[model samples]
Target: MPKRRWLVAPPAPSTFSARFPQFPPLIAQIFYNRGITTPDDAQRFVGMEDVAANARIGDDPFKMNGMSQAVERIRRAIREGEAIGVYGDFDADGVCSTALLTEALKKLDAKALPYIPHRINEGYGLNSDALKDLKEKGACVVVTVDCGIRSLGEVEAGTALGLDMIVTDHHSVGNELPRAVAVINPKQNDDAYPFQEFAGVGIAFKLAQALSDAQQQSPLPNAQTLELDALLDLVALGTVADLVPLVGENRTLVRRGLARLNKTERPGLQAMMQQAAGKNRSMSAGTIGFFLGPRLNAAGRIEHARTAYKLLTTQYPGEAEQLAAQLEATNRERQKLTDEMTQKAREMVAALPPGEFILIAGSPDFPEGIIGLIASKMQEDAYRPAIAMTHKDGVMRGSARSIPEFNIVAALDECADLLVRHGGHAAAAGFTVDNTKYDALHARLRNIAERELSRLELVPTISIDAEASLSDMNWKLLEHLDQLAPYGYGNREPIFLSRNIMVKSARLVGTEHIALVVSDGVVVWDAIAFRQKEALPKLAPLPKQVDLVYTLASKVWQNEPRLQLEVKDIRVADL
Candidate 1:
């Protein structure tokens, strides 16, 4: 592991506690450190959007460029009893969107059918064969979720075959937009919607809201039970899994969705929760990202996504139980494959020169399904951008994961002429290149990495949000910090950097973790640093004094709750 470069922001205003008179000084400092300075900003940051917390609950659905038109077409389909097919991608977000929209349309009286392409065989987006099949099955309108922003050719194919498309996606748009009945993407060039970072399921929720509004005015039969809030369970799963920022409407959605997820009435969700040992435990964004999302995504990674799809939407108890069990088994297989690939890829990269800017490893023997997982591990191990590829039938399909300093998708877009198809976000992307262009693509990407990565320090960094001591710790302080719950990619947990800590005892646990007993001389705190056993050598020596960056966690054992320091990083004290 490389040494980490610590980054700390400048000191907060001394009058923060005076400006926000409702809280203590410590809480006010945290608000300021998090960029919430004003009373109104502090109110909203803590999800107090009711009193002075109004920081834009959610953007108006009608403000989106084509939302009104899409609503009109969807309303017509529901009234006429047309077969509405929802085309979805093969990821967790895609599955959740498909399930969400399908359930929404079903309540609105449309015979909505979900059509998810197989990841291994059908690839991604709306393929022509599936579109043709849906049309042959008497489907009149097709809506895409989490995909189809770049499927101009397939959209045209469907239109020529008399299939009307309503493209609802959140990915980037290309030079030419798809010709469809209505395109409801916030990222559209003409869209003035204030927030453009909605996940695919977030867009679907907007459509559902429009449908609910139409239902209320149109004297629909099920108008009284259109609790779109219930569908928020789907939104939370997808939003958290998609890695969208949990700041504004996304935060409001996840906070509420997590509540519903913890007490979800859906048989599938209930069974899966019970299977994952979540009977009485609270569910947070981290819970979904770590446990639920992986299980939902395991099917897509190995074979077909339809298994996970059925697991989420199924209403029968027995079927839900069976699907949940299948998914658990599949997830285990995914983990095994990922570990096996990572080991092999490690050896492959070990042979490369130490000064290489990027880690690119591939083999014909590698399974295409686990390439993304392999790339992710390599990026973490080397603290540099990494790409893992698999070769089959004159084509190379690969997944790339990048650090904060590099944008892999932009790099792929810059060298688009050397690839067949590519699309993704800043930190991760997937692309396909011809076998003959593999060397050229690798060379071009390496050159770009050389120009970009050569200038930046290659060590990982831990950002400290505030400075505090053990004397300030108390139950009330922990309660104040609890307001910032449901943290994820954008909204992270707060870390405090405290100096002059003594390490009394340190022991290795589970091969890679370190359990420590430390003190600020007045109070002793039990700390556990996961995956940082190597730091024991630096701490076990005589000096004893060290600087610690850590988050406070409450651990319960035998009905006793105690505060534990979850160590993030440590270094010798600045004496």
Candidate 2:
């Protein structure tokens, strides 16, 4: 742990409610801080629906990039009764995107099968052999979801075989886009879609929307009517897991999507819920990201992601239950692997120069599939740029985690001359490089970090909310905070900084927890700091007062409800 720095947050702004008349002062202040200002915006923020309107269906279909040709090509295949296959990636986003389109096609009475490549065995995105195999299955058209943006060679192979492909993905496009019939990714250089922050599932949903609109407008006899809304559950799961900013259309989709998830009653979800007993029926973002998403993701991490996809979209209750349980068990196994690998990676990085800005470690058995989780854990432990790698077949594959100050993908781009492939956002990314170049890559990366990072970058700081009095620690205050529900990666719970207070009593409770009863004349607050038992000797005997920055939360002990404060940082009072 590092030494604490004491600083007080400014008082709450007065424009909290005046600017947004719909919210209570506290809720309004929270909304204002979170950047939701107008009444219309606040309403949409809470309810998730601003305007009830369908997606825009482009006219002069040929004017849209590749879509017109792809759709017409697919319709011809259906008329000729040619088999069609859907290929997907192996992550939550990929699974949902694949399932969304498959369901939409099924609803429209089209015969389409799904195929997801294994993460460990097949790696990411589309591949040459996989496309050829699909083409051999009597398929004339192939649709790809959440992948294929970087698969130029694979697309060309299918095109040469007279196979048309429609690519729906959200990854950044390479210099050369795939020659697929229609590429629906918003990141494409020629794409004009207004929203660019969609997750892979969101892109797939947009295609479904467009397909439905096209069907509705067609004058052909017995034309199928498309239904796209049925896939929102998958969209919400994928979008939130992929960590896209939940604002605008994304926000509306997730807000309503979570509601649908709670009452989902889908055979697959119900079976998963039974496997994960004791969970609340009213699922929140935490439930999806922490509980469900991980279990679904575990199949990809340790084995193949197809099991998770099948579990989500399966109709057989028995098969769903068995698959969901298998996924739950796999997640537990994944936790053990990640924890061990993370610990080893940390020790390896710690042996390097303590001031090194970038923490890079690798091994032959680091488990290629879970390097991302290991990198994230290492980053949390060291608060630095982290990369965890695994070497196989003369190639090194890895995942990188970075802070807000550093653009990891850009850093990789700077080193692209050495990398075989790399792509992702600023905070996180994935890459592969030749094993022979590993040493030079390490040296170059460290050099870049040394020049870029400063001393302040080593230590992490907690952001505190407005200063409060000990009197403010009460049921009412805690209840008021509940309005900020559905907390997760983007929207976090509030952290309050309380002024001068005395430690009424302090003791070591659990093996490594410091329990404190702090008091001001107006109120008393119970506080706890995990893994801080050593602080008890100094804090318990303190006669002087203290100032603390903390977060207010509810603690239930033996079914008894009580207010508790989580101390973020603390300092002895100057007075």
Candidate 3:
């Protein structure tokens, strides 16, 4: 294991309040410290736009390189009464897209069947075998979501069979695109779409919006106009789960989608939320991403992904309950496997050469489904690009996770000759390599990380928003700070660093948590540090002065509400 490093952030601006007069002084200071400078930027995000106006199509039809052509193909399919198929990816993005498009096509009187490829067997993106099967199932047009940006052979198979295909995806494109009627990916250089960072479901939702407008214009004979609002719940689920930037159109979708989710009568989501014990509160993106997304993904990870697709599209309450129970059980199993794999991965890294920039470890027991999670854990623990591999089908398949400073995909591209196939974003990626060449690949990856990551850049740093006095932790300040809701990936909650606070009292609470009483000479507040019982000796004499970085949160238990400090880092304050 490598030695740890700490990078302290520079001090916050002293003139933050004067610089931003629109926001309250405390709020302005917090925002400025977090690098949010402009009033318009804060208003657009923190205000949570009243309506997702960007979702609406213009008086002039929405134009892109292939949007019109894709819409025409689907319109022709509806007019001809031909069967259409939607081949989707396995993740939340894929499931939501499949559901959204299926419902939209049904309103247009088109028989649109959904097909999600199995992660374990079918792998990601399109496969020629699946296309041939869907083609034989009486489908005339095939639309792919969340995937198919690199499926040239599969598209060729569909085209050779006289089945027109339309691709609505957001993954990066390779050198050659599939021979589809239209490709609606924002990442394409020729694409004129306003926003290119949309998740797969985002692109699908925009297409649904455009199609709904097209239907209103022509009013398909004997067809009902589709309402797109009902699908926002799925859009929100996929967008947050995929960790796409929650700004611009993505923010609007998630904000409006969360409101819809609170009232969502979707049987599948309701059943899962109920089983997870989160049905009582209003659904937030945090609940979806942390509590619900993992359970839904567990099905696809360990067992068959079809279980999740079935759960998402299920109409019967009984069926949804049964699938939700299955998903819950699978999630428990997944947790156990991941825990075991992570421990083994840590031990393997321990045996490596003392100081390596990258951690590349492989084991046959590392479940392919959970290796991605294990890789992510290593990256956080070591603050470097980490890769975890498992020998599957005589080949070494691995998942790579990188920090913001390093581009994992581009790093892997440098060693493309050793890999069979690889494609993903800058931070996270996946690839397959020969088992015999694993050693060579690891050496090459370590060399790449050495060149890219400097010693100072490899540390996991805590970013503090601003220094504050204990008296500033008031209800109004906490409430105002919460306007920055739905924080993840890009937008993060503010963390404040304060010094020389007295520890008035301390005790052990529950089994592993520590409860504390602290004062800033103005007021005393109650705080709890979960799983910090081991740090009890650090405050043995009840120090009069202490320093810590924390976020303010309100905790409710047994209907009793109180403010609490969620500690991020702690150290002795210099008096």
Candidate 4:
């Protein structure tokens, strides 16, 4: 890994002492350092809500643009005993929403069948062929989750074939919206939803909650009732997997959802956690992002997503075990493929000019399913927006991942004349083009990126909370940090810096880890640098003093825990 520029925020103002006396001085400063300003803000930031009870009232679903109509249409289908199809994408968020809504409908006696598109065969959104197949299979009403927002042509074709469509998606809207029974998306240009940053599955959950509430007056009122909290495990999984900010309702949902995840009754989740996360480990955003989400997404990436949806919906224990094991192996294969592709992509970009604002790489043999992962890896290495494509059947399908300074979807919008279809968020998006247009598209995208991106943003930065003395690291400090539980995107884990610290001793541990005993002269601490064995040369010449960027971490063995510094970056003093 390249050395990162440590960008530490200035210390909080002195008024913090008089303002938040209830909190310890350091705790108050930490909150300020994280952008907290008012006392109420601090209270909300540090306080934990009863996520399970949802004691903090959530937004009403009826307020959403098409939520009421969507609920009414689905309820009528359920009451009339119609065969309904739940169409969804192939990612973790889409799979979870498909299962959650399907299960909710099944309890109402409606034949709710989940139809997840194959990542490779169907690509994304509502395809005309798939719609015809669903209609042929006796589906009268089709509700889409996490997809179908920009499918204007598909929606028109489906309506021509006698299908009533309801779209519940959270992706950014384009010039046209689908002409479905109800088009519900929070990011619409004129949308008035209180919170606009919900994950795709979050929109589905709102629909499920509204349907559950509407069912109170249905003839099947005595049917299995829906518990919104019960589905939070899926919510936590998708929200974290999608990497949406964990603030506002997303935060509340994930915080409570993680609790549900830990004790999830879903046999698939239970078995998946056992295999992916190991037994008895606490659930966190990291757990979902690193373990659970990948296995769930693997079924979609390299295989049909049904493998995961079936795992979530199946009630049989033996089936769940087999599916979870399959996903585990698939995930391992996915990792191997990603590593190989990333290396090949790196080699491709090694010859690019350093000032280029974007990276574009493609090959006919590259699996379209893993293009997003490749784009992300390219962005990480190049520190610029990236596009990775797969050439097949005379077309180039590409996935774009961008830096914060560049809006890739908008860039695609500028070059729309050369593209077949394109839609996504500011940070990431996808598109298709005739193989002949790939070169023109790449050139246009690079020009747009260079014109828009600032040089400062082309460099990766590590934001440190504050400089800390080793003496200040203690159980009391750790206790204060507990209030910031359930951290993820936006609400990230705190990072601290300790400068000019003497290394009493250092040793290379295991295969690629460095363990050290360090001191600030007055106090001593133990530190570990994982996957950073190359730093040994920099820390040589014995008893060296260095500047360290780190996070306070805990290491436990045999039921006893000790504080340890997780060294993120190391710089020799005055280097």
Candidate 5:
């Protein structure tokens, strides 16, 4: 792995600290680093103040384009007793959106059928076969979640089949909009929604909220009214898993949703929590991102997404337990496969000519489901935009993960003619191309990345929020940091730079990790450097001192909770 560039935030002005006297200087510096300058913004960001009073224009669900139309269409379907199909992708966000909407609609006495396409067989988005099946099952309307914005052909085919399609996606839109009954994407050029970074499940939550409000105003006989808050647990799960910016409306939603998730009554969630041995741990964004998200995603990656959807929607404890165990097993298998494929991908990239701005690797043996994981690992290891593809028959399907300096989706857009289909965010994207066009597509993408990234430093960077000494590692500092709960994409957990720390003790925990006790001459703290076995040689000399970048964490040892440093990176101290 390449050495990462450390970018530390400059210290906050004394006046800025004075404005928020209640918080420590470290906390104030973190807030400023995140662009929270005013006292009101800082208070609201830390959850001391309510967001409802300071909500943006996009906070109102009705303000979203096509929201009213989508709500009315779904409402009419419920009133007329027409079957509604919720079509979703195979990822966690898609599954959560499908489950959330289906549950919400069923509560309103609507005939709702949830459908998630098979990852290997059906691929992504609204497929004709799935639509035909839904229609044959008596579904008159189909609403898509997490997909369909760029699926112009699929939407057209569904329309020709007489299915009224309502697209609720968050991906970047293509040149032309789908001719669906209603299109609800905040990224639309004409949209007035202030915040445009909602995850697919977040948009589904908004649609559900609008429907709930409509149902409340005009009571449906025998209808069980749904409380929107109950659905936020799904929103939080999908939003965090999808890597959307955790700010503005997304932050507020996750903040409240995490609270609900901790006390979730859903049997599936309860079963999953118990299986992960997290029943006693406080649920946070990291728990969802690392533990819950991967397990939920493993179902789709290994087999079919229907298993995960069932796990989320099931009410039976026995069934939930069975499903959770199955997911656990599947996740283990996925990790193994990813590790093997990543090694192969690295070998392939190593064979490429040096100075290539992008890394591209493909294999007929690579499983289609885990290509994204391989691509992500490639990008992380190489510090460059990376693409991993699975070639089978006459088509090549690929997933791309990019560095912050490059937009993978935009690069794909420039090669639109060469691709059969493509869509995603700036950082990640997926595409399909004919075997004949694969070479052309590869060259075009490499040229784009070279043109764009040649002038920029391509090293991986770790942004440190503040600099603190070993003496600052205390329970009170940890408490103050807890105020910024549910950290993610936009709001990351604060990382501190503590320089020239003496290594009191050091040993290898695993093949790739190091366990150590460090001190600043006055105070000592336990630290763990994950994936840093390469640095062990430098610490071999006893009493070696080094600069450490880390985040504060609490670990239970001997049934006692103790503060520790989760080291991110290490560098030899200056002589």
Candidate 6:
């Protein structure tokens, strides 16, 4: 792995800190780093104040462009007893969106049919064959979740088949919007929605909220209703898993959703927790991202996403347990496959002459499912944009992962003529191309990356939120930071820098981790440096002094709760 650049955040001005007298200086500085400048904003961010009321128009689902039209059409479908198909991508975000919307529609007595495309066979997003299948199964209306923003042709084909298309996606929009009945994407150029970073499931939740509001105004006798909060578990799962910025409405949703998730009565989720995490383990954003999300996603990456969708929606405990076990096994297999392919990809990149702006690796033997994982590993290890492709039968499918300096999707857009289908966000994207165009596509993307990134430093950087003394480490400080729960993507855990700490004792923990006891003379703390065993030689030879960048966490060992430093980076102290 490339050594990361450390960028320490500048301290907030004293005048700015004076506005929030209640916060500790450290807490205030951390909040300022997160763009929380005012006392009111701080209170809202920490949940001391009502987030929804302070959200202006952002919390109101109807304010989103095309929301009203989508709700009206969906209500009409419910009233007319027309079958509605909820089509979703294969990833966790897409699967959760499908389950959330399908459950919500079913609550309103709508005939909801959920469909998630297979990763290998059908690929991502809306497809003509899937749409036709839904139509044949009596679906008069098809609502796309998490995908379809760039699928103009697919939407047209569905519309031509008399399927009223309502697209609810969160991906970056294409040049022209799909000709659908209603397109509910906050990222649209003309959208008035104040918050635009909702994950696909977030948009689906908003649609459900709108439907619930509509239902309340006009009574549908004998129609079942669902509490909006009930669906938040799914929202949190998808929002966090999709890696959307957890700020604004997304943060609020995840905050409340985490609460729901910990107490979720969904048998499938409970079973999954038992299989993956302990049954008693509390669900956090980390839990979802590291444990639950991967297992849910493993189904899509390995086989079919419907297995995960079923696990989320099933009411039977027995079936949930079975499905959860299957997912666990599949996730393990996925991990093994990813590791093997990533090594292969690294070898392929290593053979190239150094200093390439972007790394491209392809193999005929690469599994279609884990290409994205391989690309992500390559990008992280190399600190450059990486694309992993798998070729089969004169066609190629590639998944791209990019650094902050490069927009992978935009680069793909520049080579549109060479692609059969392509869509994604700034940092990640997927594309399909004929084998004949693969070389041209790779060259065009490489040129685009080089032109955009040649002038800049390309190394990955670890951002340090503030500098703190070891004395500042305590339960109180950890509690203050805990207010910023459900951290992911945009809203990250605060990383603090503490310099010249003595490593009193150190030992290797796991294969690539170091467990250490450190002190700043008067204050001693337990710390763990993950994946940093290679740097052990620098800290070892005992009582070595070093500068450490880390996050604070409370962990239980031997039935006791203790403060532990989760080290992000460590370096030798300057003489």
The positional error of residue 51 in candidate 4, measured at the CA in angstroms, is 2.0
The root-mean-square deviation over C-alpha atoms between each candidate and the true structure, in angstroms, is: 2.4, 3.9, 2.8, 1.9, 1.8, 1.8
What TM-score against the true fold does each predicted structure earn? 0.95, 0.87, 0.92, 0.96, 0.98, 0.97
Can you give the lDDT of residue 478 in candidate 1?
Answer: 79
Candidate 6 residue-wise lDDT, 1-575, digit = tens: 78889999999999988888987888999888888888878887786443332122237799888888998988898888899999998999999999999999989999999999989888888899999999999999999999999899999999999999999999999899999999999999889888899999999999988888889899665579667878888988999999999888888888778877888999999999998988667889999999999999999999899899999999999999999999999999999999999999999999988779999999987899999999999999888999999988789999999989999998998999999999999999999999999879878887998899999988779999889999998999889889987688998899999999999999999789999999999988999998888888887589999999999998888878899999999998996
Which is better, 1 or 5, measured by lDDT?
5
Instruction: Name the Cα RMSD for model 6.
Output: 1.8
The backbone clash count of each candidate, in order, is: 0, 0, 0, 0, 0, 0
Instruction: Report the C-alpha lDDT of model 1 over 250-295, residue by residue, as the tens digit.
Output: 8888877887787788888888878875576568887899889988
lDDT for each residue of candidate 5 in 185-205, tens digit (9 for 90 to 100): 999999988899999999999
Ranking by TM-score: 5, 6, 4, 1, 3, 2
> What TM-score quantifies how close candidate 3 is to the native fold?
0.92
* Residue 125 displacement (Å), model 4: 1.6
Clashing pairs in 4: none
| Winner of 2 and 6 under TM-score | 6
- TM for candidate 2 is 0.87
Q: What is the lDDT, from 0 to 100, of the residue 114 in candidate 6?
A: 93
Pitting candidate 1 against candidate 3, the one with the higher lDDT is: 1
The residue-by-residue lDDT of candidate 4 on 1-575, one tens digit each, is 55578999788888765688887666777788877778889888777755536453368887889988988888787777778999998999999989888888877678887899998888888888998998999898899999899888988888999999999898889888899999999888877788888888898888888887778755564368677788888888998998888888888888888888888899988889999988978888888998999999999999999999988988888999999999999999999999898888888788788778889888876788899999999998777889889988898899999977888898998998998888888888988899899879888887788789745556678888888888878888787776776778878878888889999899999989999999999988999999899999888888999998887877786778989999988889884
What do the candidate models score in CA lDDT, each in turn?
0.85, 0.76, 0.80, 0.86, 0.90, 0.90
Residue 3 displacement in candidate 5 (angstroms): 0.5
lDDT of 3 by residue, 1-575 (tens): 33333334555465655766766676886666566777776676577445553455222226556888888889998998899999998777788788888888898899997898887787778878888889899999999988888778778888998889898788777777788999888788877667777888888888888788789778888688687888888888888988888766787788878888877788988898899856576677778888888987787789877788888888999999999999999999999999899999999988988777888889889888888999998887777788998887778889989888898988988888898777778988888888877778888988888888755446666767767888888888888877877777666777777788888888998988878888888898887777667667788787557886778988778888789897766666776
Candidate 2: regions farther than 4 A off: 1-17, 47-73, 219-226, 277-281, 454-458, 470-486, 501-575
The Cα error of candidate 6 at residue 479, in Å, is 0.5
